[model samples]
Target chain A: MSAAGGSNPEYVIARVRARRSALFGDEEYRKLVRMGPAEIARFMEESEYEAEINALGSRYSGVDLIEYGLNHNMAKQFNDILDWADGRLYDLIARYLRKFDAWNVKTIIRGIYSETPRDEIETDLIRAGEFDDRLISRLLDAAEIEEVVELLSGTIFADGLEAAYDDYEDVGVLVPLENAVDRAFYEQLLDGLVVGEETKQYREFLEAEIDFRNARNALRIARSGADLDPTDYFIEGGTLFRAAELAALATNPDELVSKIRDSRYGDRLSNALSDLEEADSLIGFERALDAALLEYADTLGYVFPLSVTPIISYILAKEREVDNIRAIARGREAGLPPEEIEEELVIQ
Target chain B: MIEAIEPLMTALQSEAASGPAISPSAAAALAVGLAAFGAGYAERGIGSAAMGAIAEDEDLFVNGLILTVLPETLVILALVVVFLV
Candidate 1:
């Protein structure tokens, strides 16, 4: 692909930077937390989501409209990035966007398991992944889990899901199947990732993400005091903890704290570890991870302005936007006050 | 693409090997023209990127225009070449 055409990283980065600056910052989320769902949707309609809002207005209303608009805007913005990128940029961006594909696949499988209608499952899908319409349509048409696995034959999720299907049959739970998909995606993300000066930095950024995710999962399992194995949920390629280490640490919260305190991420996550000790809150730890990821992305962007880091940073920020907006909308609907709702958002 | 430059390189070299490539005025003109070519090449990239930015947000028009011509200083420097030639 790189041989067929040269990429314009500088040009694309310039445009991406412009778009990045337009993403909502802390103050915006704070204000958004103060508004009701209708007000939030109105605010979105007057912002970058205007077109999506207007288009989905007739089909949905209130929080549903906001939800649809958010999804629509996410798809559109990501599609625009794909449209602008060329050659290797396209490849790099596609690598990350496939996360959504993993998300959609999980959603579909869970929905099918719960016996949801195909159309309803389809509505939850974000079509920003590399999966073409035909593939998705075939997936939607699948009548059974076996059929779904068969339909996914050519995709990255195929083999993993096939194996997981066996475990699913034996256990009669979807954990194995869903985990297979997540592992497949994460494994593929770092496969064959040769790095240059710039992409090296991008690789590091990605590792930070992997590390944080593993940490979050470990913390969740640790907090729940569940009997399940932590290694069962371990994702590869993170620089922090190994599967065995995480499995061991999952059983002891204090030891996990000391382990995290001594790791390379210790400095960045110190406050979170303290909060974990004091408030006994996983939310604080999760927010700290988010903040750390955002800070890492920011640093990476400056270090490699013309590479994939900025694009990845933008993707992270955009995802955060969708999450924050959703949090605000849901919080309002649940009758939570603005300040309490704001606590649920991660705006940095 | 590279072959195009080979003949031009030869022509320039042959002219210089002569008693003089041209009169001082003509030599200066050549210098200015070369500078202008370089500037234009630089502008091609900047201008396209600037236009892209402007298309996304209209407020960038002035900043884009300024950046597009930043390389024009090369041509202005070549103006001195005109006098020296």
Candidate 2:
């Protein structure tokens, strides 16, 4: 996965395409929505997840088995991708996969803050990031949040965590530390990205992701009617809103909807925006956003067959599959109806 | 430099007047060599891709092998020049 040679996108894309075709489709989800957690796990055992299921079968059963299998399969798939990619492809893919690193860091911090068991925290990690196992094990061994921050020194999060540690000391809340991790991840996502002709669409897709994230955060703050500043949640590199504009728009829901209605994403997000206006619930609108982004990424893969977009599209789709199956399993375990569970899925 | 090249130019013109430097068969061989090089370059990408596919699925081994050699036809077609010469 090291960036040291010429990129071999051809080899990597071929394998990625083969794997993409094997992902679960709408039919699978429809069938899964009606099954119990055990049946769902059994169904997964007959497919690409067979190996993961068999390996973790003894350790977990029922919904927990399904959850752990999904995590393990996802981590394995993404790790294989990193192993196949070389040179610039490795760098580009690794850049995006760093989000897992951010997720793991936050999970570890939250686990320590809540005094959760080390084994439980360890099980929650998705080892698809660039960080090695030794580093992760060391992080897991740390007893305090301060030790976690100190262990993260020499990483991209080091500076941000260092700055945020002072605020954590003052307010004694984990919010500052968590926000610093998120900001660090998002900031480095687009940093120094060489936008060539091939990567132009990829860059645009990233911008859309950032824009949707900002919009979601703004709507969340608006709906909560909290007295916090929206600028604190504003992520740079999105074309939708500046920091001051986002702060101003966060106060008015109607104006914010109208603003999104007129932007470049308006055409794709029109249905979601309208739903947000009519319904008081944010779940439907958030699902719509996920579906739109999935569809957008699906189209991007076809436009450039040889670039990193296809791999990224497959990555997103796989993550969605994992999330969908998890939701289905969890929903069934909760005794929710099939129709309601289907509503929770984001199939394109 | 001009004075140095004058004798060389006169010698080259004499040799050209006598006969062409390379025979047609030799030229044909050169063409085939270039064609083979081109085919090799084309196969470089396809071979790696084919290997990747085969690595994912064992059934694709035959298909990958077939596709990897598809570019060899270029070199074979270039062999016709040798016969023509």
Candidate 3:
């Protein structure tokens, strides 16, 4: 827990491996998909989510209980990992976890813009980031988007958000602010990362994530046929597409798909790429991207057992578990068939 | 400094001509010390990892303890030199 001391990767990896073993497997997900929301709550109470489920049991019911329990448990588990890491490990982990801070800031800005109640917005805020509760509370109290931007002035999102605020004023849309936040998060993701042998794979993983994000943005713009400039949404640090290239590729989905097919990720994403051609929807392709990334991180963890890879793999797996469970619970609540819900899960 | 150490140097040279710089037992002792140091360094990682496992699940205490001390075999093997010398 001491950030000043040398990193304790041995300790963290040990604990993380133990926890990783406890994560839901294919059998568990297969069983969970069949269960109703109430049954799922009961099922979860007997597992790693027991504490969160029980704590929120009386306050919420059905899918809401499951959703809240998943969020709370995810936040607690990630926070525990952060607390356990020290020195370089903490910095590395915090770099990724700061995405939650970005998520919270965007949530708050959107809530302020939409005039949503503070309490509702508070529940949506995931406290798994480096931002402390005080700053988060202060953010929640900010009545205007300008105040939210001001509160984050000392953060990485400050400069991008400030510039985007002017765009927001001109367009009267949240896209500029949200994109700015996303760009800030991605920009800082690889900022000053020390690329040792162990971290080289990690760097590649981060780059792939950025690449996927950019690809997803380009594909979306292309599919929607919106006259929006893809360069505006282009995140740096991705090797796959330059901003100018993305601008060009966004006009033609076929050429964009071919470009991705020829890249290094082509082999891994070949199936998803074909599925994209057949389905004419990006949802399956997007889910495949997530699954590919998760599987890649999972394998990389074993390549260097003592490095930050295992911890990151655990983070990704835990997030996937949360997301999968949420999808199942929400799907069941909506009376969606088991087969469709199964398709929605991003399991490897 | 050279002039001051000339007599000491002659004495060390004479000693060196008759015998090894260190006695066999002393050399054995040095090996054991180095071996023990290596074991301790190895155990530092194992011990922390074991403690982490034990913290997560109390039933792992016995397993953790065994793994933590597995490296001590190096020291024990090194001790055989003490008797051999």
Candidate 4:
């Protein structure tokens, strides 16, 4: 159980595999999309989400109950992984789970800046990250945005927030602070990672995610024809596009599409790229990216069944399930037709 | 001092020549020991995975037990080398 001991990928992978199979398939999604919010809640209770649904059932009903249950279950599941992992596995996972830390921080900052109630903000905070209950409570208790930033002084966000705080004072917008937090998370993601063969593959997977994100941002900027510089949105460490290249490509959607099609991800993303060209919609392109990333992770898992890949694969699949369920619930609540809701899903 | 050391050296040499450092039976025992170690190493992963599966679902108990013991065949194969030796 000590950090010095070897990783227990075997045990984690077994549990992960079991959970992966429990995720909703196409049939479940079809049924869920056709069902009303109450029916969806009922359906969830009969499945893997039974406990969360039942626990939240009394307080809230319909979509709110479903959403809260999903968030709570997601946090619990991810936290359990961190609890079960030890040694380097824990370190690797904690690094990734820090995304939720960033999520919580941004939510609190926004809540304070907008004068949202503390209890209302609390419901939005996902407890999946390395941040313990004490830290989260402190953040929630902070009355001002500055106090929230000061509370994060010892964290990875400290330096980034310190720099961004100046920009916030000058511009009076939350964008700079949010970007700084994101940059901090992405920067720490691959920092000083000692690359073994499998870890190198993992690194590549992460880089691909960064690349796709950058590409999506570029595409959106190009589509919008905004006067804002694309370089501001450029995330470092992606191998696909340099900052200067992105600035140029962001003005030309065709060139951006061609560039992505010519890269190493071209084969896997060919269909998505073509869809982007034909459909000319950001949502479809984003869904395609999600599906492609999910497929890539699944392949990586099978290729190296005994490494962190399987766990990562499971994590991605679980996140997708949660997203799909959320989308279905929200879409149904909005009275969107089932066919349109199906389009919103990124199911494989 | 030289006279005392000379007799002790000869006695030690005579004792060394009386038997081999490691007998064949001892080597065979070493082989079984190493084989058992290999089996245990293999079982470590399978056993953990089986336990995880069993913990998830009660129906998997039998399956988990079977997979957990699959690595025992390595020790069994190593035992044949014991008989041959």
Candidate 5:
């Protein structure tokens, strides 16, 4: 309990595990998919999101209420993680949490590029990263993408963003800058950790994540038959696809699936891969990847009980809950059928 | 090197005649104190983990308290050495 006693993983994990248990079960999602937007909000108010839903209810309604509640709960859960962690534990958890920074930066740049209002952009940011309020406010206040990049001057994202700004100019597209930010985030994710037995396993887990992301990107490119270069979207650090291999494999769906089937992730993704072969729906396959990641994270939690893996696993589950709730609310608002909406929810 | 402490044998004779400044009972008591220190050190991690669980659920307080004191069994066993001595 003493602040001076340093990191309390036990307390954090205990609370996290309790919160993890409270996430919406599969049955809840099934019931939620059948409800309307107002009904979804009502359901949320009775769950772990009650505080967030009540707090944001005055300003937003229906799907917006669900969206704000989801984002707020996401921020609160992650911020609690950072607050609980200390020493090297803080360092490890914060590394993964930088995804929010990537998300915030991309949102801001896209908003500024499209001239969306600052207030709207600010609402979307999950303030759970290493970035403080001052930095985020500065980013919001910036009138242009250049100014936004300049505002982030000394952060890890600065250099890559600055470089991508040129590519953004040449093509007049936001893809370059977004890719730069994503590349920076993943690059720094596993950078400079002390090598040990447990960390080695953690490293492999991260690499698997990167590999899955690359596969998703490649599959989308191949399926969409986009004229854009697949290599450009290829993120480094994944063991599955080298950058050059993406270009050739991206043109042929059968070869791409075969290559993935032979790779390290083959075992974890066999069912999803088979589904892709049968149904030819990349969306379902992507959802399968997400389920596989969730299951893998759960396994990692039990293997390294007191390590960073459980903490990350909890984060994933919480994020999934928020996403599922939002999907139900949005699906209801959009008048999508219950069964279709239920398909969108990744319950596993 | 294997001469087996002739100087300490002579010192012991002289020292024992002076009725030994530190008795075996005192030595055993010191052992108990060190064992208690070891028990306290072991309790540190368990105690923190217990408090953590208790904080999440009030119902766990009793269980946490029980687990926290489990290491005290070491010190209790160390007490047996005092009686033996």
Candidate 6:
């Protein structure tokens, strides 16, 4: 649909709300955590993951079956939303779904670099983004990273990837290329958005995500004491930190935490800041950030029920569900205790 | 319709009177037409939303239908205005 047409928020919100109601609640997660891999797969079979489990049941078993089923279901659910959206709603949503495009491109590139088989790479792909099967197949068939860059020529990632390729060639590291793809995605998110009152909240939510991401990256770099410049990791458009400010802040852990505590997210993340100060653990802080973002999105949905916010809220919730289930299956496979595994989940 | 237009045409020809342009019954008709338009506009969003809900779950069809037509009350109230006039 053309951008000139009005958004069908009421319809989109209604459909998204129905799907949102189907997501696993806290009780389901509790039960799933206690179960073994086989039991968990069976549990999923009886729930929303039924069709996925039955469809993949013939070929795979155990955690691999559950993993593939979860990924496939996630891709299907997200693609269904994208298909249902129209006009401006489609534009707003496709902006976020393009994260999967970045994921697919990165997966294909890493697979090629590691000499992984095509089918192995294909299984990891989410396929929930804008890329059609033809383009993705072409990407998978490309032997060289340069070819992947070339194949993405007309796309948003093309310019960023092409420029980053020079750095990749120079340093023989995929970091620059990956950063380029991420930067391109984040930059395009807020670019040229025509902000109405409803979309201003959507824009703020996007900015909060960027801020959280930058805060996490800065904390990680600070904790590592890496010699690398933090500005290289600094994403644009967040209210939290400027690139130069982040570069300076990355050198000091206490100052960086305090900086985040002083920002607009200070109130929401106050507990997380104290936790970071006391435990010095980034994982818990990151999870807190995730919960805060989820809660923030939920508030936005409540504040503007028929706009783009609820759809985004569902998207985040669905992605968290998929991630939580994957964590459960993998944690169970690795023989971790249920409590520790539960600690890793970011349910809200 | 032709008979209704006859008085409006005569009024247009006699331009000296600076008063209400249309008769009270004509005004009431315009009000009901606008009220129906408002009802339709209100139902447009609700009907689409209800259809979307029903598409996801067939059991919601009855509920959707009920909500979709809830705005028809506007026209019904405006019909009361027609009678009172």
Q: Write the per-residue lDDT of candidate 1 for residues A1-348, one digit (tens) a residue.
A: 132244366567678778888888877887888888889989998888999899989988889899989998998888788888887788888888998889888888888899999989987989878887788888888878888888888889999999999999999899998899888888877787868877887887778778888888888898887788889899999888999989988888899889889988899889889999999988778888888887876676777666778788888888888988988898899999988987777777
In model 3, where do residues sit more than 4 Å from their true spots? A1-7, B1-12
DockQ, ranked from best to worst: 3, 2, 4, 6, 5, 1
Q: Tell me the spans in candidate 5 whose CA falls farther than 4 Å from its real position.
A: A1-7, B1-23
> Residue-wise lDDT of candidate 4 within B1-85, one digit each (tens)?
9999999999999988998789877888888889889878878888888877777777999988888788788778877876886
lDDT values, one for every candidate: 0.84, 0.91, 0.92, 0.86, 0.84, 0.90
lDDT tens per residue, model 2, A1-348: 113433378789889989989999989988999999999999999999999999999999999999999999999999999998887888788878899999999999999999999999999999998888999999999999999999999998999999999999999999999999988888888899988878888888888888989999999999998899999989999999999999999999899999999999999989988888888779888888888889878798787788889999999999999999999999999999999999888886
- Provide the TM-score for each candidate, comma-separated: 0.87, 0.95, 0.95, 0.91, 0.90, 0.93
Model 4 chain A weakest lDDT span, ten residues long? A1-10
Clashing pairs in 2: none
**Ten consecutive residues with minimal summed lDDT in candidate 2 chain A?**
A1-10
Candidate 5: tens digits of C-alpha lDDT, residues A220-324 = 888787797988887888788889988998899899999989988889889989999999988889888888888777777787666777788889888888888
Top DockQ hit: 3
Q: Chain A alone, model 5, TM-score?
A: 0.93
Worst 10 residues of 3 chain B by lDDT: B40-49
Each prediction's number of clashing residue pairs: 1, 0, 0, 0, 0, 0
Using alpha carbons, what is the TM-score of model 5? 0.90
TM-score of chain A of 1: 0.93
Residue pairs whose backbone atoms clash in candidate 3: none
CA lDDT, candidate 3, residue A212: 96
* Candidate 4 lDDT by residue in tens digits, A1-348: 224554377787788888888888988988889999999999999988899999989999999999999999999999988887777777777777888999999999999989999999999989999999999999999998889889999999999999999999999999999988988887788777767766777788888888988998899899988798999888888899999999999999999999999999899889888888898878878877888788777787776777677778778888888899999999999999999999888786
